[model samples]
Target: MEEWTIEINRSATKKEKPNTDQLEFGRVFTDHMFIMDYSVPLGWHDARIIPYQPFSIDPSAMTFHYGQSVFEGLKAYYTPEGNIQLFRPEKNMQRLNRSNDRLCIPPIDEAFVLQAIKQLVYLDKDWIPTAEGTSLYIRPFIISTEPFIGVAPSHQYRLIVILSPVGAYYKEGINPVKIAVENQYVRTVKGGTGEAKTGGNYAASLKAQELCSQKGFTQVLWLDGVEKKYIEEVGSMNVFFKINGKVYTPALNGSILEGVTRNSVIQLLQHWNVPVIEERISMEVLYQAYLDGSLEEAFGTGTAAVISPIGQLSWEDKDLYINDGKTGKISRDLYNTLTRIQYGKEKDPFGWIDIVNEANAVKQ
Candidate 1:
C-alpha cells in the first residue's frame, strides 16, 4: 500500500469575494484549487493545492480532440451552527470512479481524493455563502493531457477540483418552469457513453437545449436514443413523474446518468411510503396520465438545482400543465426537506452529512 499525500501551496493574495445576493451559478470561483497528475509509472502524483489560475496544456491534448474526460459535481454547505458540511460526497466520488471506468481513465483513491476535497474546501471556507439558497459548488474533473491525435485513450491525465459559489442552477429556482420534450435530437443510447459523466454527453445535449431554449423552455426533457419514445432525463438532471399518487422515474438502464439527488429523492419518498417506482416510462404513458388527470407532479433532481419542479411539459405541440402550473405538495416538501437537511436546519436521518474539520485538512 502506498500513502497518497497532498502538498499545499497557499495563494499569496486572496481574491474578492462575490456578494451573496448577486451570486450566480458557477460564475465566481474560490481562491485555491486542487490538482494532481497521472502518468504511466508514477500513477497519480504531485497532488497540490495552489492558486486558482490557468495552466498551459498542449493544443493537441486528447481531451480536446478525442474527448476522454469525466467530471463530478457536488456541494459544500454552511450549517446554521456555522459548521461546514457536505451531503453524500462519498457518492460523488463513487460515481466519478464509475465514470472513469467508462472512459478508460485510471482509477483514483476515492478516500484520498475526498480528503483533498475537504482540505481544499476548508481552506476556502470563508467563501461559502450563508444566504438562503446558496452553497459552494464543487467540480472534480479529469482530462486527458497526452497530446495525441489518435482516437485511443491517453496515457497521461490531470485531475483538478475547483470550487464555486452558486445561488441557483435555474433562474426559476425552486419554482416550477416549462420544459420541452425533445423529439428530434436524442441524448444517448443504451450502449453509448450516456451513463458516463463525460463532456461528450453534455456536449450532445447543447443542441437540443439550444432549440428548446429558443422556444422559451427552461430545459429539454430527452428521450432514449434508439426508439426515441422512452423518457431518458432532463438536460441537466434526472426527471420524475408522479401519477396517481405514485412517483415514477426512468430506470437506470445503462442509458441514464444515475443522479445522486435522484437517488436521495427516491429514498426519501420510500421512507415516506410514497410508492416510488423506477421503470421504463414512455412519454406517451406520461401524456396519457396527464390527460386522465392522474399526473399530479413532475420534477427534475440533480446536485445543481437540487429539485426543479416542471409546471408545464410540451410534447408534440401539446402542452400539459401540472398541478395547475404550481409547485406540487411533494415537490415543495422534498425541496424543503432536502435543503433543510443540507443546511443543517433539519435532522439528517440518513446519515448523509459529512463534516469538514480544519485540523484534519492537510498533512504536510
Candidate 2:
C-alpha cells in the first residue's frame, strides 16, 4: 500500500472539544483536513494533511459554472474500548467511484482513498464525539477546479475530506417525520444523474424540499419522473415501508440513490430473519396499503440519520398515517441495533466496523 507524506499543522486551537451533549450537526468542524490535487499529466498527487482552511481557486473554475462536483458522507464512531471504528466504509468508497464514473471523473484507487480517510480520521480522533448519540461526520468531495469557461470536462480536480462532530439527528428522541408525496416536481429521470452523488441532483431537489418545508412537511417523497406513480426516494434518503409486519423498499431503478444506510438496514433485517422485499413500489399501491392498514410503518434511511421514522405521508388531498404517528417496532429495533453495533454496544457479526488502533489514531 502506498502512503502519502504527512505535514502536521500545529496552529489549531487547543481549546476544549465541544460538549457532545450540545454538538450540532454539520456546525462544528475538526481542526485539520486532508486534500489532494489531480492534473491530467500528474494524476492524483501532492496529497497532504493540513489545517482546515479554504483553498484559493480561480473565479473561472470549472466547478463554479458547470457544477461538476461529487461528495460522500459517512461517520466514525468511538467504541467502548476507546477505539474509533468506521461503519462499512468500503461501501462508501465503492459508491464514490460509481459517482465519479457517472460524472466523467477519473476513479481513484479505492485502497488509496480508504487509506487516506483512515489517516484523516486518525488525525482528528479528538473530533469523534463520545456521547450516546454523537459521532464524527466525514465529508469527502471531489471537484473540477480547472480555470476554464469551456463546457467540457476539466483536466484538473481537487479532492478534500473534512470532519465534523454531530449530535443526534433528532434531539427530541427519534421523533417521527412527516413526508409530502410530491407528484409535481421530479427528482430524477431514468437516465439522469440521480444515481450519482453529484451536486446537480441535490441542487435540483432544493426547490421541492423548500416547497415541502413551506407546506409543513419535513421532506418530499419523490416519485418516478416518467409516470410519477412509483415511489423513488425521499429528499436525501431511500424510502422503506413496513407492510403486514414485513419490510419493503423500492428497488434500485437507476433513479434512486443507493445509500449506505439502506444497504446496512437490508443486511440487518435479513440477519434477523425479518422479511425484506425490494421491488417496484407504486404510489397508489402504497397509499392503498396504508389506507387498508397493511402499511404499518414508513421510514427513510440515509447516512446522516441512519433511519428516520416517517409518521405520515400527504399526497394530493389525502393523508395517510403510519403506525399511529409513532416509530414502529421494526424502525426502533433497526435504529437501536445499528447504533448499538456502531457504538460497540453489540457484537458486529458482519465485521462492518473498522476499529482504528491508538497508535494509528494520530497522523504519523
Candidate 3:
C-alpha cells in the first residue's frame, strides 16, 4: 500500500562471515537497518533503509525515562531452493499494533510495515545463513523519542528494524534445559503490560533471571503476579506441558504474551490429532502430575528457540524431571516437523511461509 525508499549503504564492506557452526544468538548484525520516524500531525514518515548505526537520542528520551517502548522478534529462513521465507510475519505486525495500543503509541500500517521488512530482508539477503539451525533474526521495535521528562506518553516515536544472523538457540541442538520456578519475584499482574511485548516486562525479569541463572537454571519460569499460583510463562517463551496424553498450556489470561510459535505448536498438535488445552495451570497441580508420573513432556515455544524442552523444573527446592530429563518424543517430533516446514524441506500444509523477493511482495 505504501512505498519504502531504498538507500544502499555506500562505503560498506562485508565482514568475514562467522562460521555458522560457531554462531551464537543475536551477537552479530547485518550491514543495514530500517527506520521510520513518527510525530503528531505528520504521522509516520521518512521510511528508509540505512547503514546500521547507533541512534542519536537525547538523555531525557521518554523511552529511557518512562520505559515506553515495544518490540517483536521473528526470523528469516534460507530455504533449500535458495529462497528466503518468513513464517507468519503478519501475526508479528498485528501484535506490534496491539502493543502500540497498550503503550499509548500510534498504530502503524501493518501492510506497509510488512513491505518495509521484506525490502530490508531482501537488501540483506546474503546475510541469511544457510547452515543447519541457523537463521537471520529480525527485531522490529518502536521507542518513544520525545526528549521530554514527564509522566505522560511521549509525542514523538521511532520505529526501527534490525537483522542479526544467529546460530542454534541451544549449542547442543534440541537438548533439554533446566528451569527454576520464580516465586518471590513476579513478572506482571493482570491488566498490566505483561501481554504487551514491552521493555519493562523484560527489564523487570532480569533480576530474577540473574538469580535463577546463578542457581544454574536456564530461564526463570514466571507465575502470575496476582495469585502467584497459576503458571504464566517462561522469561522468553510461552510454555506447554504434555501430561496424560494431552497438551496443556497457560492460557492468555491477560498476563502472557501470545507467542506465534506457541500458536503454531498448538495448531500442529491439533492437526496431528494430539489433544491440546489452553487454561490456567498451577505449579502445584503440575508438580502433582509429575508425582503421579503423568507429565510426559514440557517445552517452551518462542521465535528465537522454536521449541525448548524443559528437562527439569525446580520449584521450591523440589525438582521435577520430565521424560527422564531428556528431550521427549513429542518435543523432538514437533521440533523436527516445525523446522522442516520452516526450511522449506517439506511441503507446507499450513500456508504459513511467505516468500520474500517475490514480485508485488513489496512495493517499490
Candidate 4:
C-alpha cells in the first residue's frame, strides 16, 4: 500500500461514543477523518488522517457557487469475531471516479483511496458499533475549493472521507414502505448529470421528496424526465420488480444511478438461476402486470436499505397495492442473504468482503 502520513489525535474522543441503541442515520460522526488535496499541476498530494474538524474554506469556493461536487456512500461492518470489513468498496471508488469525470473534478487513485479508507476505519474501529443492526457508515466526497467565481470547472479541489455510526434501517428486519410516483416533478433527463453521484442531482430532488413526504409516503418514485412514462428510480435507490416468476428492473438509461447494491442483487439472482432482466420498464406496463396479478414482489436496492420492500405505489390519486401491503417472500430472502453476507454471517462466494488488518494500514 502507498504510504499516507498519519496524525493521531492527542485527545481522542472515542470515550464519548454515542449509545448504539439510539443511533440514527448519519446523525453521529467518528473521531478522525482523512483528507487530500488536488490542483492543476500538483494533482493529488498531502494525504493525511487528522482529527475530525470543520474546514475553513473561503466563501467564494466554486463548490458553493457551481456545485462541482461528488460523493459516495458505503459501510464498514464489525464481524462476529473482532475484525472489520467493507462490502464492495472498490466499486464505490470506481463509481466516484465516474462521477468525477462527469463533474470535471480530478480523478483519484482508487487503490490509494481504498487503503486510506481502511486505515481510517481501523484507527476509529472503536466507533464501529457492535449492535446487530448498527455499523460504521463511510462517506467519501470531493468538492471544488478554488476561491474563484467561475462558470467553468475549478482548478483546485479537496477529497475528504468521514465516518458515522448508523442505526438499524428497521426496528425488526426490513419492513415495507409506501412510495408516491412523481409525475409533475422530473428528476433528471437523458444526457444530463443524473447518472453521476453529484450534489446537484440530489439538490434537485428535495422538493419532490418533500411533496411526497407530505402525502404520507416515505419516498418518491421518479419517472423519466423527458417522457415521464418509464420508471427511473426511487429517490435514493434503484428499484426492482418480480412478476410471474421473472424479475424486472429499469435499465441503466444514462439517467439512473448505477448502484452497487443493485448490481449485487442482480448477480445473486443469476447465481441462483432466477430470471432477471434489465430493460426500460414503464409504469403502465407494471400497472398492467399488477392488474393481471403477475407483479408478485417489489423492492428498492441501495446502500442504506439493502432491500426496501415497496408495499404500495401511489400515482395520480390512484394506488397500486403490492404483495397485499406486506413484505414479499423474495424481498425477505434478498434482505436476509445480502445482510448476512454483509455482516460476515454467510459464506462470501462473491469475494465482496474486504477484511481490515491494522498491520497493512499503518505507515512504516
TM-score, every prediction: 0.98, 0.96, 0.96, 0.97
Clashes of 4: 0
lDDT of 2 by residue, 207-228 (tens): 9999999989999999999998
Q: Pick out the ten consecutive residues of candidate 4 with the lowest summed lDDT.
A: 6-15
lDDT of 1 by residue, 1-364 (tens): 2587778989999999988778988888999999999999889999999999999999999998988999999999998889999999999999999999999999999999998999999999999999877899999999999988899989999999999999755445568989999999988899999889999989989998998899899999999988989999987899999999999999999989999999999999999999999999999999999999999999999887788999999999799999999999999899989999999999999999999976656655
lDDT of each: 0.92, 0.88, 0.90, 0.91
RMSD for each model, in Å, please?
Answer: 1.3, 1.4, 1.7, 1.4
The global Cα lDDT (0 to 1) of model 4 is: 0.91
**lDDT score, candidate 2, position 219:** 97
What pairs collide in candidate 4?
none
Q: After superposition, how far is residue 7 of candidate 1 from its true place, in Å?
A: 0.7
Candidate number that wins on lDDT, 1 or 4:
1
Candidate 3 residue lDDT tens string, 1-364: 6664544443267666788887878888888798999999788988878788887899999998999999999999999889999999999999999999999999999998888898889877888999888899999999999989998988999999999999877666788899999999998899899889999999899999999999899999998898888999987799999999999999898889999999999999999999999999999999999999999999999988899999999999799988999999889999999999999998889999999986523343
- Poorest 10 consecutive residues by lDDT, candidate 1: 166-175
Error (Å) of candidate 2 at residue 287 is 1.3
Q: CA shift at 106, candidate 3, in angstroms?
A: 0.4
TM-score of 4: 0.97
Quick one: ranking by TM-score, best first? Answer: 1, 4, 2, 3
Best candidate (score: lDDT): 1
Q: Candidate 4 on 192-257: residue-level lDDT in tens? A: 998899999999999999988997999999999998999999978999999999999999999999
